[model samples]
Target: MGGEWFEVLRPPYLPVEIRWERAVADGLPADVSHAFGIFDTTLCGVQEAGMSPSDHWWLPERESACDACREAAGVIDDRRPRAMRGEDARVSVARRL
Candidate 1:
């Protein structure tokens, strides 16, 4: 809340959105599910509920967002092509001497 609302620009996303000075200034939920649910809503609510004042939403200051931030907020990586099941996309091996 100490930072300027305008200073923090909305991330580029398909559905343009804006965020306030979001700060996780409290103890977090003991599990992931609850945390995820809290963030499933808006930044304001999240902040009020002790989450970050800055959070992701479908609309930023009532404007549609660019595709990039939108997808990322929704945990979607569009730039990366779809992968097949059991695809060996990487190779890594470590041996200790």
Candidate 2:
């Protein structure tokens, strides 16, 4: 596992009372139906069992996201610049050619 984190909403339909969870990005089920039966433990110790297939996975704004999960997962601010390396450090595609 690369220790990547993902924001997940177990019950997708809820708008006002929605609380996003930070889950491990590795080994996520490819089939939505398969995900429903499995138990998922969030970073903040929330366990989700027999969840719905409608569960949504996305990056929500920090304000609406789970504070405990985010802190536990050590999520970095997206607005901050990440260090570039290897192929990603290339100045331009034309230079490579």
Candidate 3:
């Protein structure tokens, strides 16, 4: 049988079932719980959503997203060009110095 597949990600400190609450506690608008279903599939359906290794989902359009996630996305976005040039390691390290 074929079935649609989905992914859900949540921080470890928060119960997986109450991930939405964690989003709210983190200062994101409460409506976010409804804006995107509390899963990566629905989260990615929202424009410009980002998933982190720590199992957090962020909407890139929202200024209210977790700072570290947004900044991490920004760092990755900033590196795309250097990566395309085949010099990501050198440039990424140089930028940190």
Candidate 4:
């Protein structure tokens, strides 16, 4: 019954989408199909049954997200290109590690 919502700022496929995930019980679902179905069901639900307080229609309060989510956002933000011509691309990738 107890679970935690973690924000995924930079999913591998879509870097710009703000996504949230629920890690309940032991951990997240290992199967992609299960994960997708679970997430979709929760998100598509009405009345915000299992949704987080910050989970609005379009605006989510990232600052209020859990520490893990915040950290992920930071990591993603850093890796994203900061300039048009990749001026900041020269930055060492090791920083992410």
Q: List where candidate 4 sits over 4 angstroms from the true fold.
A: 1-64, 85-97
My TM-score estimates for the predictions, one after another, are 0.18, 0.30, 0.26, 0.27
Against the reference, the lDDT scores of all candidates come to 0.33, 0.36, 0.36, 0.33
Candidates in descending lDDT order:
2, 3, 1, 4
lDDT of 2 by residue, 3-74 (tens): 224322122222212334334333544321111212565544555553333455423444545555455434
Root-mean-square deviation per candidate = 16.7, 13.7, 15.8, 15.5
Candidate 4, residues 1-97: lDDT per residue as tens digits?
Answer: 1222332222233232344443222233323211111432433232223423223222124333344444454464566555522322232223333
How far is 30's C-alpha from truth in model 1 (Å)?
16
- Model 1 misplaced regions, further than 4 Å: 1-23, 26-70, 74-76, 84-87, 91-97
Best prediction by lDDT = 2
Q: By summed lDDT, which 10 consecutive residues of candidate 4 come out lowest?
A: 28-37
Cα lDDT for residue 21, candidate 4: 46
Greater lDDT among 1 and 3 belongs to 3
Best by TM-score: 2
lDDT of 3 at 25: 31
